[model samples]
Target: MKKTIYLIIIVMIILSWNIAYGEDLNLSGESYVLIDAETGRVLYERNAHKKMPMASTTKIMTALVALENGKLDDKIAAKGECIGVEGSSIYLREGEVLSLKDMLYGLMLRSGNDSSVAIANYIGGSLEGFVSLMNKKAQSIGAINTNFANPHGLHDDSHYSTAYDLALITKEAFSYEEFGNIVKSKSYTADREENNYFYNKNKTLWEYNGGDGVKTGYTMRSGRCLVSSATRNGMHLIAVSLNASNWFNDNYKLLDYGFNNYNRQFVYDSNQFIKKIYVLNGNKEYLNLVTENSLFYPFKEGERENIKLSIDVPDTIEAPIEKGDKIGYIYTYLDGKLIHEGSLIAKSTIKRINKFESIINKFKFK
Candidate 1:
């Protein structure tokens, strides 16, 4: 019995060590990253900041900018510049008109280069203006290392985005319900004269459980690039692979690793009561404090118990407190590193006691 117990103890120690260190995924991508879609926390990354050309994935941003700037029902005519564009296309004809929604379906599901140009021209007034919007959106969303030279992901030396930046862009894009609906669609039929049918090229949606959106890209210079997203047990993860030899399989491993290792846990809810604070000389003796925003974070195995929450507030606050007034802050940390923070605000108004009331209270106490 003693020998068996010793062996079990050794095995348990090994298993605990393995869980702490994590497994090495030896992915076939030159640059790859897996991130929590909700928290934007990176679960795994390998050379993720290295910039590389992304082929048709450029349409992701194109679709996003179009959705933000244009109405889905607006009719946009294909420009002369979109005709006969090289690479994948929806075979757009000059002067052909399609609704912004239909054009987006073609752009994402079919990887339509011409569709990108059409959306760009109609929404931005010119291809150059549209590309500028793409770059600006990228930068605005913290994709600092990314640059967009065109609406379509053509091979341009100036057009490049890193895996990390691509994941950031994907996270931002997924915030739109319309964009998510469009990319996850496997088939779409546009209401046009001809060649209106499209089938999504992303194979992960069919093979992987809970697989959804994103885009795929390929060019001789860029190799095969893929951005994939999956949701399991309320955890949405986004994975990006650049210059990957096995783009689909690489994402599978990346996403599988993320799901297997991390679990999304709700930390706080918006307007959640933190604690009551004593209010001196106020109509109310105490005021409730509530959080400003909700927080959810991914936790690794055994890591939940280690999380620490610190609330910073005064011991007693003076009266005249207004609802929603900033009073304090609540910070959440894991392993001594801050993970999330939110403002603690007054939950209700607390008017100061009138002079007469104060005098009466003093007299009653005496």
Candidate 2:
């Protein structure tokens, strides 16, 4: 009995160790998180819930609220108030005029403080109003740990965000085509009235493959900060790092882990045959249902065997169905737990049966 108890204790220790360090993870940062943009699922994390100074990443939220509330094509006149706002500038001259779109390019790509203020003033009539909008937008998007004291992300003691909240905000920003386009740009030239041009300040665009536009920051108090995004194959991952000693290396390492260990595979393609379902009193006895878009899943290496696919389809769907109508659902499972779901849509319309055929079908059912 003594020997058996000793062996059981040894086994429990081994099991606990395996559970604690089994994910092939190595990371260093005060707060960090990698997330899938499409699904908003956290792939890896370290201290992700701890709120810290986010530095220039605050511009992401500023840009988002500005774009959502203000028109892109509207002209913005650079006022004296925008001058000397401090830290990263597109060098806007007083009284200079540019479209809101050009200024955003300047703001996001160049990380321009002046442009940030210009946008804030143009959209909200004052910086305080714009900051209020930023905070409101953050709350609405589930960024519970975020607060915006200024539009440019200047280091204010009150301004802070958690890794998880930054990821959430970025995922929301990615939904805007304008935001996505601006961030991915490696270089953008903003022309002033006299043919003066300013180039983008983000250096990662030139350094990494699929390194689209995001933001980077460094302050005496905030250390080095970066919000980077990349797409390879069909997978797009967003990485947020705050107060890291090595921003670039940490981001690259996190991105490499994501791409190397996980895969985005198409479980189902649009208009492809999922299965056939029976139809009642319809012109066609059977109808084909398929996905409208390719369903992508991120699976760990060698873990595909653990994944399962299941389809939930209704029997005898009613007639007069419209094409592309949702008819069923396809679920992807891991270890018998559903991880993802895609809609199964009708491949083509199913018309109602003629009166004679309907009568015959009714009699057959009886």
Candidate 3:
């Protein structure tokens, strides 16, 4: 009995260790998440759902809101109310005229609070109105654990975001090439005029290889928060660290883990032939259905063959089909679980076959 009890305790200890650190390698932060930008899959996470003060990372959402709602080339006049908001600044003075694009550069790369307020005022008519827009956008993007009290990420209790939510928001932000370009720029010179030059403050663009420009933030109340993105070998990843003891180390470690462990594989390429379906009474005897967009998945080296492709197309299609019409779907599976799903669209239009033509073909073939 004593021997059996000892053996049971040893087994329990091993099981507990495996349960705690089975899939993940190492993680150190109050909250952290590593997500594949292509699929939005949470590769690694710790305390991701816990809401915490998000410091300057909040500006990512600010930049996104401004980019979508405001025009880039439109000139924005610095209102007297936006002059001295506080925190990080682009050193804007009253009556300063700058393009919306330049301000966004400052807002994202420099983490300027004044730029946030100015954008909020310009796009939403007031900071309050802009906060409303921000909340709405957050909800639309499925950022449920996020709230916006200010355009700038000050240490208000009301202004907080979870690591998972930050990853989700940044993933959406990356979809806009304009936004992605601005954030990824290591160093850019923004001209307020012929004389004034504003430089980006994000040092990661210069410090790290393949480092894209992203916002960094710190406050006594918020501790240290950083949202960083990097692209390697055609795979993009977003890493969020909230209240981290060492922001640079944590960000680098998490980003490296994602890049090293995972690779973006084309599960389904656009216009690639997925399946062929017979057409009944149509001009074309058969129709080729293909994927509309390239489906991507994060996979390790030996896991390629384990990925299964299941094409769920209709066996027979009807006539009068327009080109590019969605007919069915392709689902990708890993270990019998669906990982990615894409639509199968008609490759070419199929007009109805004339009754005489159908009869003649059937008789001739017979």
Query: TM-score for every candidate vs. truth?
Result: 0.87, 0.82, 0.90
Deviation in angstroms for 355 in model 2?
A: 5.6
Query: Which prediction has the highest lDDT against the true structure?
Result: 1
Candidate 1 versus truth, CA RMSD in Å, comes to 5.0
User: Which of candidates 1 and 2 is the stronger one according to lDDT?
Assistant: 1
| Winner by TM-score | 3
Lowest lDDT sum, 10 consecutive residues, model 3, at: 18-27
The candidate, 1 or 2, that scores higher on TM-score is: 1
- Alpha-carbon local distance difference test for all models: 0.90, 0.83, 0.83
Model 2 accuracy (lDDT, Cα): 0.83
Task: Provide the lDDT at 301 for model 1.
Answer: 88
Looking at model 1, report the run of 10 residues with the lowest lDDT sum: 17-26
lDDT value, residue 314 of candidate 3: 78
Model 2: how far is 262 from its true place, Å?
2.2
Off by over 4 Å in 1: 1-23, 278-282, 312-327, 350-366
lDDT value, candidate 3, whole model: 0.83
